[model samples]
Target chain A: MECLSDVGFSGATVGVVAKRAGVSRGAAQHHFRTREDLLTAALLHMSENRLAELRRRAADLPDGAARTGAVVEMLIDAYTGPEFSAALQLWAAAANDPRLRSQVIPLEEHVGREAHRAAVDLLGADETAPGVREAVQATLDLARGLGLASLLTDDEPRRRRVVGQWTRMLEETLR
Target chain B: MECLSDVGFSGATVGVVAKRAGVSRGAAQHHFRTREDLLTAALLHMSENRLAELRRRAADLPDGAARTGAVVEMLIDAYTGPEFSAALQLWAAAANDPRLRSQVIPLEEHVGREAHRAAVDLLGADETAPGVREAVQATLDLARGLGLASLLTDDEPRRRRVVGQWTRMLEETLR
Candidate 1:
């Protein structure tokens, strides 16, 4: 998926991914019976990778405040990182593919739920409070958007500033 | 740009757009000397159209609250609307083209500026307030992201709820 998204998904061939991943074409074939299967697996892999990365980044943080801070920084890094760029590109490709959409939507919802839960735990807020989860999720969603937009522009300073502002804004909810 | 974006800018031939817009090939060529030019012009044109729609929507309401409310709704509509989907597809294409990026980046910045300005005016907040602009822009960005995500999933209720939550969140920020 990374190779395909990075280079353009529709044009991504099995041979390209095999070569890129340093695996034999036969080995690649064994793993993915078809191109569509490869694409599906890659998308799922990326979603899982992102969630794990978020958790790893927030692991050392003390609570909601620390977690919010850590999560913002991690999210910034995630969006701008080489790996996540591939993921973002895949997401763009999925936006245009119905098969890809079916695979991606539920994962997306699950990720949103996880992030919301984390934010609640981090902020020490009541998960059921009116607008609380929604507000926090909105902040998370906004951070992801800004991060992706900044990545596209290759603007590091802007990315840092946006991330910093987001961390601060999320922290505000704690107060 | 909408046509190009809708179809994947690189994949979208000028011929397709001319056909989609119901204009002659010659007419399309006449208005846009090159495909790149057409894309730039299209995105600018759409932004103008969006701004115009926003103005009309907010026309009945008082300046601050009305503009805030109306702009958020307009943004929701714009992101989910047909034309913007095309523009978004073009955005993906632009990600791969440096020339297209040059055209898109500035326009994106302009929209961000316009959004920030509107928020400031509506909230009666100073632009220089440390995090005010960032927060407002972040919320708008969040709405757009959620809108895009919702579109990919065919979730109308999720879309409606997020849009409402977004408006209410912004309302809280202003207060």
Candidate 2:
């Protein structure tokens, strides 16, 4: 997944993936036969790993402030990091390759919906509430944009401010 | 830019780009000596073209209804299309390569800020208003998320619905 995100889909060959993992090609091929299989497995692994991380982080909420902080942090770590990077590669690749598209689109959408639901829960907000869903989506979307920005330029402080301010904005909007 | 977005940094070699553009390798290299230079030039060209299109689209937005509709359309087109895809490529590519990061980060941020300002104007919103900046930012951010989803799947109807709903929400907030 990291390799795919780093070099993109066309470059994430089986041999490259194996070499990046510090394993022989034969060892890698033993588990996954083709680049597609390897990449698909990696994408799934990334999504599941992120979901677990979100749950663990949301395990103990200290207060409203801490909860908000946790939510923002999870949003950044989940969508703006390697998970998103890999997804970007897959999304672009899937556009051209129908086989991969059929496999990737649903999985990618599922991850997005799952993240949305988790965010709603973390905020202790009802998705059905008036304007609540849009507000929540807005927060995540803003975080994504900030996260994308960070990828271009590791401006941690600016992204921090944007996400923090966005969290507060959502609080008021939801209220 | 399309090549980078489609195949990513590593796959968007000079040869691939030249082929994609239907130009000779000599012709392509005459303009950009290296892959990084080619991609950077392409990225800038994409941004400039989008800005021009935005300006042209924003030319005669009608009253409240048409204006909101136009804003939503512009938001969707600007972010969800190839422009964002290429930007996504540069973004992911810039993550580890500091040289690429340095080249891309500023360009990405500048494009972002320009887009934000244009969005504000397109929406007829006041950037100086209280919470207005964040509100505008959120609107663009939500559109971006919707756009990203569209790239993975042909969720045009759903994305259209989200953008329309968010536009209404922003109308209430901005007013």
Candidate 3:
């Protein structure tokens, strides 16, 4: 996570990752024979780590706008972290590389689907209701845009304001 | 643009790009001088090309949801092309390379600010109003997320559904 996110996928050499993990190169090679093997393992590890965090965040929350706000907050925080950077690197790299694309597509697909399910569960929002599903997606989607903006500029204040505004609108529309 | 987007920033060799363009390596080097020079020039060309399309798409339309849908269509179309691929390349590369970051930051900043302005104008929505600003931002943000999803999956059916639903909500909220 640290290597991939901090330096990007292309920069995440086995040498760098092994050094970061405080392991010998030989040991690292023994565990993961190739770059693809290492990246797949890293991504799976990220998913597991994120799942644990989501479960923790999902614990005990009031329903309605309050719950929705918490879910959005969790999403915003996640996107602002190193994990997002790593996923972005994969997305960009996979755009052209069929080899990487083959590896990343399934990883991303499973993660994206699960995250959507988690968001609905955390918010206790009914996806079957009229317009509710789109509102749910809008919340996550807006968070992504705000997150990308943060990478280039320190627009946290604006991001927070937008999130607040969006949450309110979501409640009014969905409720 | 194809060379960079299809091969990535690191993989975009002068030899490959020149060969792809049916030009001699010597001639390509003479025109671009360096990889940075070539990438920057390519990015500028993409920006100009996109600006023209945005302007054309911003043409006269009925205010309210109709206008909102049109703008979203423009955004979706933009993402379904080479420009988005190139932009993604810059974003991924800029995360680590300070030199590329410096060149891209200003380019992205200008494009983002203008795109937001154009969106608000095209929608004829009052940015100073209660949730109008956030609605505008949300529209663009959501489109971006949908665009990213499209890169990996053939989710056109879901994308269309989301756009239609988002347009209705945005219409009601902005109005």
Please tell me which predicted candidate would have the highest TM-score against the true structure. Answer: 3
Residue-level lDDT for A52 in candidate 2: 79
- CAPRI-wise, candidate 3 is medium
Ranking by lDDT: 3, 2, 1
Q: Give the TM-score comparing model 1 with the true structure, all chains together.
A: 0.85
What lDDT is obtained when candidate 1 is compared to the true structure?
0.65
lDDT of 2 by residue, A1-175 (tens): 8887677787789999999899999999999987788888888888888787777877777667557766777777677766676777677677657788888877767777887888888888876777778667656666666555555545676566556656665666566
Please list the C-alpha lDDT of all candidates, in the order they appear.
Answer: 0.65, 0.73, 0.76
**Weakest 10 consecutive residues, lDDT, candidate 2 chain B?**
B158-167
Give the per-residue lDDT of model 2 (tens digit) for B51-94: 87887877777877668767877877788877677776666667
- For every model in order, what is the number of clashing pairs? 4, 0, 0
- The TM-score, computed over Cα atoms with residue i paired to residue i, of candidate 3 is 0.91
Give the Cα error of residue B29 in candidate 2, in Å: 3.0
Model 2 Cα shift for residue B52 (angstroms): 2.0
TM-score comparison, 1 vs 2, better candidate: 1
Error of 2 at A97 (Å): 3.5
TM-score of chain A of 1: 0.78
For DockQ, the strongest prediction is 3
Q: DockQ of candidate 3?
A: 0.63
Candidate 3 residues B18-111, lDDT tens each? 9999999999999999887788788877877776778776766656557778877776666655667777777778877788788878877777
